[model samples]
Target: MTVAANGVLPRPSRRRPPVTWGNPLTYGLALAVAAVSIAPVVYVIVGGFRTTPQIVADPAGLPDPWVFDNYARVLTQSDFWGQAFNSAVIALGTTLGVVVLGVCAAFVLARYTFRGREALYTFFTLGLLFPAGAAILPLYLMLRDLNLINSYYAVMLPQIAFALPLTIVILRPFLAAIPRELEDAAAIDGTGRLGFLWLIVLPLSRPALVTVGILAFVASWNAFLLPLLVLGDVSLHTLPLGVQNFSSQYTSDTAGILAFTSLAMLPALLFFTFAEKQIVGGLQGAVKG
Candidate 1:
């Protein structure tokens, strides 16, 4: 028996609760997981500042003198900026296309119950399973036939097509989560189908839309194979292709390659950082719904 604060004997000190081994083990495992996940990013950041010789010599240590010229070279280089612009345009265009088409498709899929609906979804989703590389020849021929090869539109169109299925997959559930009463209420208030979508669905889907937008941006921005095959002009090359050029031009300059790689990754990094909260919130909403 335990004594009470007052002088009476209390219940055996309530036995304090037994500390299990699981708690400490779980904390240790979580810390280990976090460290593993962070190690590569740390390595990349450190390696970006080191010279080729330093990286070849150490491969793992912090840069001794911490040279910043890598960043300076990347920023000052004219090719880098132009390629970055190409990436930006493609990413923006793809995001817009995916959003417009995905939202429309998702609205139909979620709100309607027509025949062959599942088959239609399956057809759209088939694109996701088909590797973009597998479609290269077909895409090239089609774009060439349309006289769009070597043009930004060629890359932009394929990127949008490839990204649409995933965007639709993301948006469908989010659209479904919205209560039907909202749309019915809007309809009762004289809102037409387009008006209902424009005012009701679009506004409520900001988070999901932002999430898909970020995904589309990143995918299109980093697209290598499609653009590489289609875009032949140096002026039209995206960041990934530009980095490949940097590698070819500076084959002996490993430091320069690392620098270019680091520079190429910057836009994606900044975009994810800025949109991380919205992405997380959107995913959580989708999961909870």
Candidate 2:
């Protein structure tokens, strides 16, 4: 070590790990998996642009003469817009309910020391194993008795309930990881539990919240059987149901059916695509916590 004029030795420089381009084999496998997953979606979307005759002639060929009439027709339909509105309402409603309730419950479990708190958290965790399909019969009966059939609440409430388990699981770690010193500081400043949560915790947990919100929105948007069983009226049907109805009504119009299917799935795909980073970040934080 070299000494300075005042007899102080200089500190050694720290070395960082080398950057990696990763394994070519791993990248090749990822590309293969991605192509397998994406091929069908690409086919459906591109198929919408070809005539039924063209599709029949070459199932895997590109559209020689691209067509927009199918998409235009679906867009012009009043029922298409109606179904989109229904989907938006249900998705947004489910997201709101899940976020608000999940955060409050997670906060209590994370911060408060109460009897059976671990048990309670365990119970919610068990909810992850409870598939909606298993509860469909009893759920339908209960909703029918409540006279909630054919309404948005019938769809929204169940989606929120099913989504809550994962939401709380994702968020509790985030909330619990909040430095206890911060809470003490807030208390010294006269901030109560509610104020602390509203003023500090919520802001810190925004990533997890956004992650859960996007998940709920996408799940609600794609749900089909629940809406089918609860909403018998065509007017109340969401986009998934609308796709079913459209396909049935135009069984012979292959291109039209493809167009309608593409449109039906577009919203969820777009939502998920835009929020992909938020989801990855939230889960990483949860795991680290």
Candidate 3:
């Protein structure tokens, strides 16, 4: 400790915590993990701009002669946008449904005491333990019986249901953490429960909502089995389904396949990248609660 000019002892400075680079092992491990995770994505996206032979010859390298026409070709294909639209519709629909319903249900579960509430919440959480694979056959049969086999609703509804479990689980903690005094204060301001939800709760809960929405959107966008089992019409296929079909439709055009994959993957990557803070904050808040 250093003495001040006035003879008062100065406070010792705190040391900075070690960063990944501060420890060689930590830095090396992170680098290795990053390379492992990122290499495949880079190759696929970059490979989209290379000829099949170029990729086959040097799969690890950049395009020998970069090709933009592969993307242009995919863009020109009408089915590309159609599949994208279908994916968008399903993802957006699922996200909206999950967020709205999750918020409401989670609010009720967290704030209100009711009969069978614990039972209902437990049942919902149980859904997380059961994989989608377990319910696919029955889910398929139910949708088939409803004559929804060829419709987007068939895919969207199941996703919304499956998403609700995690959505409710994540949202409950956030909702519970909202000080009851805030609700009381809002009530004195003549806000009804619904108004409180919209004006106070919703705004305050934006982080959790955004996190839930992003998760739901990504899950729905990448969903394969539900769409595959429910949607029989080729035109209604989502991107993942479309990507599977593209393999057969353009087996000879590896560039097109890679380009299609990159395009399909781009949206979720962009979404997560842009809203990373909200997701991280939301998760931390949920965990803390």
Best by TM-score: 2
lDDT of 3 by residue, 179-200 (tens): 9998999899998887888888
**Cα miss at 15, model 1 (Å)?**
23
Model 2: which residue pairs collide? none
**Could you tell me which residue pairs clash in candidate 3?**
none
Clashing residue pairs in candidate 1, if any?
A: 2-10
Q: Provide TM-scores for the models.
A: 0.81, 0.88, 0.86
lDDT of 3: 0.85
> What are the Cα lDDT values of the candidates?
0.83, 0.89, 0.85
Q: Best to worst by TM-score, what's the order?
A: 2, 3, 1
Best by lDDT: 2
> How much does candidate 1 score in TM-score?
0.81
Candidate 3 deviant stretches above 4 angstroms: 1-12, 15-28, 56-62, 285-289
Summarize candidate 1's per-residue lDDT along 1-289 as a digit string, tens digits.
2223442233466766455344454567677889999787767766779888998898778899899988788789648999988888888888899899899998998888899998998898888798888889998999999999888899988888888887888888888889989989988999987788899899999889998888788778888899988899888999999988889988878777887887788778887888889778766754664
Error of 2 at 93 (Å): 0.4
